[model samples]
Target: MHVSALWRHPIKSHGRESIESVELVAGQTMPWDRAWAVTHEATQPSAKDGDWAPCHNFVIGTRTPGLAGLWARLDEGARRVTLRHEALGELTFCPDDAQDQARFLDWIAPLCPANRSRPTGIVSAGARGMTDSAFPSISIMTTASHQAVAAPLGGVLEPERWRGNIWLDGAAPREENDWIGHEVRIGGAVLRVEEPIERCAHTTANPFTGQRDADTLGTLERSFGHQNFGVYARVIEGGTVRVGDKAGRA
Candidate 1:
């Protein structure tokens, strides 16, 4: 198996960016996989009775079709983060301070009016109103799996719909879901694939436009049976990974 692509979402639920390479660290994540997200204090139409929380508080979905177009870049040092959009100005955040968070919230709030219906940051430290499935952090998908999911459609689905942090290519399609609870090595790093990442409504939100689309859920449900497409891993070692880095079952 080989890596065909890689991605990271700086802001948890906002959008995603495809990458040629990335670096991994244990107990943390690829540079920007879940750095930010949107939260809802009250139950959303999708969540039913679940109240919103911070990015740290909940799991966001990547299965949503609308997030397909969002893209981003983190400066070489992983300090400056830039979003790509026409009307919206690019904003940066300091992961270490409230000042940066406030700036990011202000910059993002006005752009996503639909998010207004949901409540803001969670009262808990580092928690947000959004919720995600059972991964401590980070989501991954394979190019072959992506192609498999898109095969039925007679073409490829955009990467944004999957919203993964790392994209592995050349591996058997859907191979990731089967590797849960095992360790795999990629480039110089070793990681333990922990679990299959479940899908959620956040996938419905367009990271670029913030529009909600429900088709993504139905597609995943029909193709994969469960509302899931990827796996979660805890970095066991740190190293640089680049495009074409070989990923093998450990």
Candidate 2:
């Protein structure tokens, strides 16, 4: 198999950025991936304390499909994030600043879905990211598997719905399932496949349009008899991985 694409979401449940290459660290999430998250006013106390909590505590596409429309760009040097939407234009701010946090809240208020807990503050967890899984993980998916899922739906599904870190090609549909508990090498890095990634309401939203246009989770359940899509892997060796690199069992 070969690596087809790489992605990072600097902020959890927000925009995604495509990259040509990325450095992986042992037992860590992808660099800058889910480094910051917007917590709702009603977020649980444990989540408010900068601890990794469930995805429900934050403003996510699952709860507000409109959020999937936003595109995010993180300027690590400037410590700022710029978010843009076709309808909302753009807003840039430093997530670490109180004033900017308030500005961010205001910027996203109109986009928040009705009756959902509103975003109140931005939170960070330093070098460790606030990933969906309690353990640090890098999500991986294959083009074949994606095609299989889309075939039954009679429509193309965007890979963004899976929110995977690595996208591979040349693997059979759902072949990654057999890879659990095994180590795979991609470019110079080695990762141990841990578990299958379950589908969520988040996948129902279209990343490009930010609308609940597809029933991805439902499709998975009906067709596959299970709500699963991708696989989660933990970095076992630190190295660089680039698009087009070979991937195989380590």
Enumerate residue pairs that collide in model 2: none
Writing each residue's lDDT as its tens digit, candidate 1 over 4-30 gives 677766656555677876777776667
User: Candidate 1: how many backbone clashes?
Assistant: 23
Clashes of 2: 0
> Best candidate per TM-score, number?
2
Poorest stretch of ten by lDDT in candidate 2: 125-134
Q: Which stretches of candidate 2 lie over 4 Å from their true place?
A: none
Q: Candidates' TM-scores? A: 0.72, 0.96
